[model samples]
Target: MVDPDDVQFIDEMPHTATGKIQKTALRDMFADYAFPA
Candidate 1:
């Protein structure tokens, strides 16, 4: 599970070509995501 306080936010549920969670995209999208300290 991801923290809600992260800098970058994607509320949409990840999905792949076969309706699977696209972790690659999600990782890429939030690669630089940083939470306030």
Candidate 2:
């Protein structure tokens, strides 16, 4: 389960050649992300 307030929206997602989510790219993208207190 996840919380809506803690979600981040983006226009696109990074994926790998195997058609899997690329966490490395996500990390780079959300490097400065802040979570709700």
Whole-model lDDT per candidate: 0.76, 0.88
In angstroms, give how far residue 3 of model 2 lies from its true place: 3.6
Q: Give me the overall lDDT of model 1.
A: 0.76
What would the TM-score be for candidate 1 when compared with the true structure? 0.56
- Estimated TM-score for each candidate: 0.56, 0.64
Q: Which pairs clash inside model 2?
A: none
lDDT of 2: 0.88
Question: For every model in order, what is the number of clashing pairs?
Answer: 0, 0
Question: For residues 1-37, what per-residue lDDT tens digits would candidate 1 score against the true structure?
Answer: 9756645546797897799998898888877866679
Off by over 4 Å in 2: 1-5
